[model samples]
Target chain A: MMHLPNHWPYIAAAYGLTIGCSLVLGIGAALRLRRAKTRLAAVESQLRHRESSAS
Target chain B: MRPTPYLLHRYANPGQFLRLARALQPWLSTGAIIFLTVGIVWGLFFAPADWQQGETVRIMYVHVPMAWLASSCYLGLAICGLLSLVWRHPLADLAAIEIGPVGACAAALCLITGSLWGQPMWGTWWVWDARLTSVLVLFFLYLGHIALIRAFDEPARGQRAAAILALAGAIDLPIIKFSVQWWNTLHQPDSITLTGAPTMSMTMLWPLLITTIGFTLGVAAVIFARLSAAIHESRTRQLMARSRLNRSDRSAA
Candidate 1:
């Protein structure tokens, strides 16, 4: 097994923070996009249904 | 590539942007995963430790990328601001709104990671050096940008206000870049630059380059994703308002 270097904890913490923040921001953006697209799709489909029924 | 009318002449329209972003996302995300994984693993395990800084130098793989991204993100923001102010591009306003928080996150991480790396090397978690102080200002600037972008009741007014702030905030970026050379600060000078050969070794440089590319891809993915959401939500709002107007006319008739 490879020996770990001194001050490994700091290194670990830094990596953890970088990875964590990136994931949170990335996932949050993806979710917002998903929600907005879904809402837009639902409204568009609803309007389509209403228009067809009216005609 | 910037989404300015100058750069993205064909894809400046939101619909064109959406089609392109959706097509590129899978490739971007997949490439981010691959490069980040390889780069991190190689930097942590295979890359030689700094002859001086030892294993702690591994932090640079992450720290440098965040630092670069934070600065580059702001540059992108300033460009978007210019686009908004000069051309009155609605997409530029939308892009600015989305870039604000992500850039802020990058700046915050750069500060935190720098602190983490500092404790082991500099023997303190914090310092008031020019490089450090300038970056702190950048963090605040990002926070201010985010807040200012949402300050006004009218979105257009808020965008204009934020655009001016972004332009003003850009001054700090050069200071952050040259701080170490200009002052006898505790922070070290840059290892890489466009004008000169990199001081860092080939082994370390490869991983750093890969990681930088990976992080950049990640940023593009997030910003594009957020911009997509904003555009879709705006469309949804317009559709809802039109539907309500049509219903009101029908009832009145």
Candidate 2:
């Protein structure tokens, strides 16, 4: 086979950065979703409390 | 009346949309990771070096995708903004706000990576090429939308103002896409253009395309995830307001 350019390091760097950033973003978003779910649950429970008290 | 945009309608309902986003995010993120990994491995080690640019040409893998995404992010913003403006969809407004920061980050990444690539090739960290200038404008536009969205005291007013700004700035998208061909600019010709064929070989082209898809899906996952958070936050705020109103009424009684 013919010689390919020895740019493996740069290639690794670029792809690695992409992966790292994407992973951080994905994970961060997931965590946010979980937090939002929790907050929503709290609000729902509070609403239930108010409704039950009124009834 | 024209038929509704099917994809939009299919995913329009907030509960359904949340379910779909939850299902798709993991798979899309995985696809992004897999394709980007394989594409990079193949492009770096397997593909032959360019005749003219030699190793430096490898930067195209990162540069081209970033360049494409930098503007494409704006397009995403505009689409979501239009949906918010025309139909006043709550999800659309949420999407508009959610996508702003992500698009801004993507544009910033593009500029930084492009500058790094340019430093090696173009002999400077910066250039006034048409593509570069338009992309800079795009970055500013993303920032402007983000700021404008948060500027107003009323959330609805802020969203409407941001929607108008987003629609207005969409004009730059086409200018950025065609700037290479239109002007006497230093930016290289588009590897991917509106016309028939690409200038690059199959070996080089496939990886680029795959990575582009990967990047795009990756963007979608991020936007969806962020939008979920925004919607939840909005719901919480509404709950808080109702509770506050109740407390005030009780105290007055």
The DockQ leader among the candidates is: 1
lDDT of 2 by residue, B1-253 (tens): 5468766676677888889888988898788778878876776677767886677677677667777777777887788789988877768778888888878877877787677566656778798989899999999999999999999899899999999889999999989888988998888877776767988898899877877887787888788888878778878989999989988998999
Q: Candidate 1 regions off by >4 Å?
A: A1-5, B1-9
What lDDT would candidate 2 get against the real structure?
0.80
Candidate 2: deviation at residue B29, Å? 2.0
Which portions of model 2 miss their true places by more than 4 Å? A1-17, A53-55, B5-12
Question: Candidates' lDDT values, in order?
Answer: 0.92, 0.80
- Cα lDDT tens digits, model 1, B173-251, are 9999999999999998888989999998999999999999999999999999999999999999999999999999999
Q: Give lDDT: candidate 1, residue A8.
A: 91
Per-prediction TM-score, please? 0.95, 0.88
DockQ-based class of model 2: acceptable
